[model samples]
Target chain A: MTDRPENDHWLVRPTTIRLLWWVFCIVLALTVIAQFGFSVKGYFGVDGWIGFGAVFGFFACLVMVLVAKGLGLILKRGERYYDDGDSDV
Target chain B: MSEILSPALILFAAALLIGPARGHWRTAILLIAPLVTLWAVWQVPDGVIGTLSFLEYQIEPLEGSPLRRLFATIFALMAFGGGFYAFRHARWYELATAYAYAAGAIGVSFAGDFITLFVYWELMALFSTVVVWCGGTPAARSAGIRYAIMHLLGGVILMVGIVGVALQTGSVDIQPMLATDFSTWMVLIGILFNAAAPPISSWLADAYPESSPTGSVFISAFTTKAAVFALILIFPGEPVLIGVGLYMVMYGIIYALLENDVRRILAYSIVNQVGFMVCAVGIGTELALNGAAAHAFAHIIYKALLIMSAGVVIIRTGENKCTNLGGLFRTMPLTAVCGIVGALAISGFPLTSGFTTKTMISQAAATEGLVAVYFLLAAASAGVFLHAGIKFPWFVFFQRDSGLRPRDAPWNMAAAMVFFATLCILIGVFPEALYRFLPYPVTYQAYVAGKVIFYLQLLLFSGLAFFLLLPLMRRTRTISLDTDWLWRVVLLRIANAVSTVLLALGTKFATLASGLLGSLRSLSERYFGQLASEESGRRGVFARDWPIGVTALWIAVLLTAYVFIYYI
Candidate 1:
């Protein structure tokens, strides 16, 4: 019931957030280059499809991360959740 | 070409020697054992070594085929490297169990018959369980139990297949079996389970990371790679494995991407790496088979190196989660370097073992015009870098410093990692040393400008993708659910629920039946008015004393009838 931001400290780090944004832009730029660079060089002319594949693969990975995070909200146990006895400590 | 016992058997004997030795000497014994075994393996003749007869069947103990020798050589090397790593750090019991496990694997490698293979296969299961137990934690005990059950299940399936094959064909030789018969399917499934194929893949992640830090390094090397060896030997050229391997490859990347535990990520990636080998086995060309073999050898070294580095971090910081760890490169520079080398090798970066080994398999797929598989494998290659190659060392060693400084890994640990790191580069730079030992003759070259440039572009771009998606790929304190959840959670819950309901229903049925029986007894007593009882005044005509007379008369009559019938 607690607000997500209130509980998760990782979301609060401004530096991390900025770094993540920078990384995202860099990856996007590379994908664009990989997709189009071969085409400009006339390397078998599969540039359009290759670009699509790269874009699709990257997004698909993003979706998986999102889905996993959502599922983790429900299924994630306490760090010691499985330790029902005294042995874990 | 000399007469000698198989190196695998000698290794087993050496393991036996270590079992009874004092603790201090046991480490020495463990270290020496593998070197001796390696020497013995080198001495094996280039033909069938020995055969034993059982009933009407012949069981070959040692076969000197190039493929078998190749696998056995690596197994011996792993034992040597693993023994050295474990010798200084592991408990005596763990050392003994590890040797036994190594012996069982090597035994399978040289086994010329299915019977010998199955026997050693089960031994691997049993001893590896002991290694897991040596973690000396309750979590390890439970995980070890589950690990044993999964492997024993695989072993049982294998046993049944072997028996069925023997019954049907009247032979037990461990030769290529490409049939679609029930027995072959059974064998395939059995091997696939150990390969950590889908639906049962969760066992590796669940059990491996739970092992003792040193134990995980040894545990990582043997079972799955041995399965790869068997697959290459028996089910080569089966197309079904292509799909199976692809599934494992993607599963490893996705799950590893989601993983927080450093070792678990590596464990998942092990499945991914083995998947490549398995897929190559499906491709089953000479090139593909060699790729699988070479990859297995290289993978064992680098993967162990990775785990050893992680093991050092865990030992020093007492933390395994990426979220809790970072910036140890400042202190543990050697470990960082070793780990990065391992990551590079695993990611198949140019001039690394993975590049030299894994590319051959992909090249085989391409040559065969399996375009879809080739593409998916290529993407998965990228994903491997995204998840493991970059993610592993990045978060553990480099990312933002958590302001916690840990010392360098121990001399022994560093030595082990350095040795493996050296092997990774040595094999990459001078692949012919490994190529000469392969099952097939060497014609493939890994280093070319086109290939190197393409691979670097692919991997580095993937690295670019991973960092760009850092927000999405951020670590969380969560364990990803895997196919094992079907058995570990759902099936187990169903079984418990059914048992509970069955017990309740049985209690109710018992209570009702007992009550009905009581009522019937009373009803009989009341309705018959105790007439059947001798104490009752109203008895039947044949009851009481008259019954005795009638019985005597009937006995005589029956005797007369019997005599008449017999005579007639």
Candidate 2:
């Protein structure tokens, strides 16, 4: 294994990144809960329920990632897969 | 001598001059060609002009309307900007071919009849193939062939439809069509093929990234947008397009999310952006049509800008995968900045072109009570940000330093990016400049507070999801299979199997046939020899030794015997 580059970027420092994640989580939770107090006409009536966008966005991403991973399992191959002799047909 | 100069002809004619000219003259032609075309476009007043009778049919090669002009103007501007970007870096032939391709698009924009449009449609296919070949790699060559075949198929489908329409209506005039019959359905399928709609959508991602970086930028602007323009003209209000367009939008996002290549992500998003326009065309309201046209215009600029920035990265580092790129912001600050601006613009940040233009499409859906379409478009907006807006910049410029410090883009390329970036913001800030040119009069306002807030909320939350799922989004050295797999793998394997079986059967048949022929030859030779000996013994002399009279007598005797047998 090669040496990792020294972390000179302030934003990517381990502690700072963790802190940023925490702040993001707090903000996301607030936005989700804010749906209860807000009367914004949601695209679906259910969207106005607490944490809808958050739940929808997160689960959608999760499902997409999982589906992609499953697809990758079947479809993924070596970089030279198409360049190989068998594919020349 | 002519009343009006066809803008497409101007570009096409100028394209011929580019190859022969050298040094500064080439640059001058490159700069002036689009300018002249733009000027010619302006000269075309509303209604058909420059009609020429061909084969007893009046073909209007130059028709002017707000929509045609709008599409033509952007195409011309795209050629100029793309030319400027590619002038110094790209080979001369590539630029010439690209100009020819652009001319085809401009021609399609102004074509008043299906015949003229079909001719130019084919022209784009032919020249763009050369541009794809300009990538100068084996991958590019094969991909170019596939690209050509797909387009040829699309052209044939479109031709059949055009012919059917002409035969049905006895007029070849450009007009709206519903998919009420086989003819119109063929036409819709044809246009959708170019638009990179599903079942054939893989062609866009398969081919575009395989082109030379500049070629990809040039390609990003045309073909599909021209298809969008065609849809607006020929197949607007067709309900099926909404489903097709939405499929493309989601397909692009899902594919892009799973993609590892930097330029490829941008390539997928082109389909995504065109999806918005296609969906709006389906909506078929004045507002939706306007939104479609306006969104197409914005999409071209921003998408090209996005691709151009990625081109810079590809040029500088010579690495295209996200796995091989990162931390370019330190040294290639200018490229990073320009790329970020493009990213923001594409993400529909409040003051970006995408926000101004794409929002109109969603709003039209909302107003029409297309609740499902509205929600999905909203979700797609966030997905666009996830897959393209953030994913492109994050992985390429800011992920982790891959320890490659390459120089920023050359001055000319950077200048091109800056010019487009400026336009992205300018159009966003003052959309009226673009709105004035839309096919319909503008009445919708873009910057209401509630809409902005909801959009921000949706996008920001999606951003949060991206970060939360960052671990899952890491780039790898593998490619995701797409619909092309059917042709590339399954169909090819089947062909190979059939050919192998046919070869074996052919060889076996040849051997058996040869054996049977040998036996027949031997049997014939033996029988003939026996017959000759029997006839000679009866005559008691060879033919050479016998007199002519004797030979005649034998022949007559044989004939007499045969006649006797017949009588009996």
Candidate 3:
């Protein structure tokens, strides 16, 4: 097997940086839009709970990610965990 | 009318016989079993068959009503279709076990009493677990164990409630139970568990997807639908189910939105579809109950079609993750088209089975003046389109090409998908056929233009939301977290930790006790003549003659003391 060159690593790749920047911009846009949209809806005599729901949705997503990571630690067996062929057909 | 055989008996006998058979016999048994059962189901008369005495309860095995027969007929039909689909792919044992499982579901549908229902309920649990294990994978084994535990837990609760009802009411007849008794609540919880209600709903997604592709198709048809049938029979007007059902609808939408595996997404949506039925049962109007029944029938067809299409994809490409799949329409056009049909049906698009059946439930809510429920359900309809209708087909079949070319589905799988897709459209266009089979008379129409237009707008906008939110809904290489974490992670960890501590303590206690005995033996050897001989001392107190005699004497002395004290 041939050894990989240093430039072949993903972190230093130009494409990776470009992709990260795109993702960062998207997230920022979503956050801004969600905040403004909730406020505008609330101002127009829509339910004030809309603001609360928006905040709750953001946090819920965050918590879901964190909880999923924690759960993955406990429940993530090897890829082959369920692939053992010892079970009866 | 001609003499009718009992579907339940035929299925049970087939299950018993198929276990020992090899190649051709097994295939023949699998193919013929459902056909026989279907014929038997068709023969059920429109009345109660017979009742037996069980303790203080009367157990009715066969009850023929239009509603019961409707579900029974469809279930028998599903078994035939599913059996044909699996006959070529699944192992003989799997086919046999699945047949037995299908029988249990049909049995529950025809059951006239709680006792008969509970018996078949447990049977479905047992046989479905066997079907899961038939996947012949380690994951399948663990999943089967978890699946069995959850079902047995539900079955025990159901059994306890049945016994309680029998003891208090002195009857086990299956009828509308409106009482708020402990037994009634227990029965509700038991049924809810099977229905994939909150907290424990993860079992359906976790277990069913882990089954073999063919096995998953059969697994999709029963269990929860049986629970829906039970709910309609028992708790028709229970208002609490509305909230529970609403939660499931959103849960399915959100989780499926986040899912990666193709089959897992479908599994989550099953809970979502069943949620609509459960909510209708809560509404408890004739229209709502009819809606629930019609939805169940529609759901079985579309869901099976969806799973069957997914199964074909998995078999063809050996990939199930959407991230790893796309551009399959080019090669597997038939499967893709069938899958899209299923997706539309599931999304309640116009001229589909879901649109015809699911709308009645929402209409029922509106008529009942359940304003909040109606709005939430309407929004949930949008969410359903976002998650299942657009996302599923888009990501799996029409997304950026993954450049993996695979052949179309095999003849059997294609035929199954075609059959179900045809049923979905037929029911959608002519819902009267389905409506006539309801427990009540048909009076509702699903073809109103205003209603159809409203649904189209809501769902179409949801599709817009999906495309607009596409960046956020990108497929990640991760499994979504669900309530199964409680059992699969938390409870499992606790059990492991407790077992470890116990084992450590046990070993330490054993070692220390042996050491103490060794010292005592040495001391005894020095004092008493050769009683603690090397070979004899190592065997410990119970194994030694001196201690044995001493223990016998102590027991004898204690007995004598007890006798004297009592007598005096």
Best by TM-score: 2
DockQ-derived CAPRI band for the predicted complex in model 2: acceptable
Report the poorest 10 consecutive residues by lDDT, candidate 2 chain B.
B535-544
> Each prediction's interface RMSD?
6.8, 3.7, 10.6
Residues B175-272, model 2: lDDT tens digits:
89899999998888888889999889999998899999999999889999999999999887889989988998888888888888888899899888
Candidate 1, A75: how far from true, in Å? Answer: 6.9
lDDT of 1 by residue, B85-124 (tens): 7777787778778888988988888888898888889999
Segments of candidate 3 deviating more than 4 angstroms: A1-89, B1-5, B16-32, B532-568
Note the residue pairs that clash in candidate 1: A23-B468, A24-B468
Q: Write the per-residue lDDT of candidate 3 for residues B251-286, one digit (tens) a residue.
A: 787778777889999999999999999999999999
Listing candidates in order, what is each one's chain A TM-score?
A: 0.43, 0.75, 0.40
Measured against the true structure, the TM-scores of the candidates, in listed sequence, are 0.84, 0.91, 0.81
DockQ of 3: 0.04
- Candidate 1 stretches with Cα past 4 Å from truth are A1-89, B1-4, B509-568
Clash pairs detected, candidate 2: none
Q: How close is candidate 2 at the interface, in terms of C-alpha RMSD after superposing the true interface residues?
A: 3.7
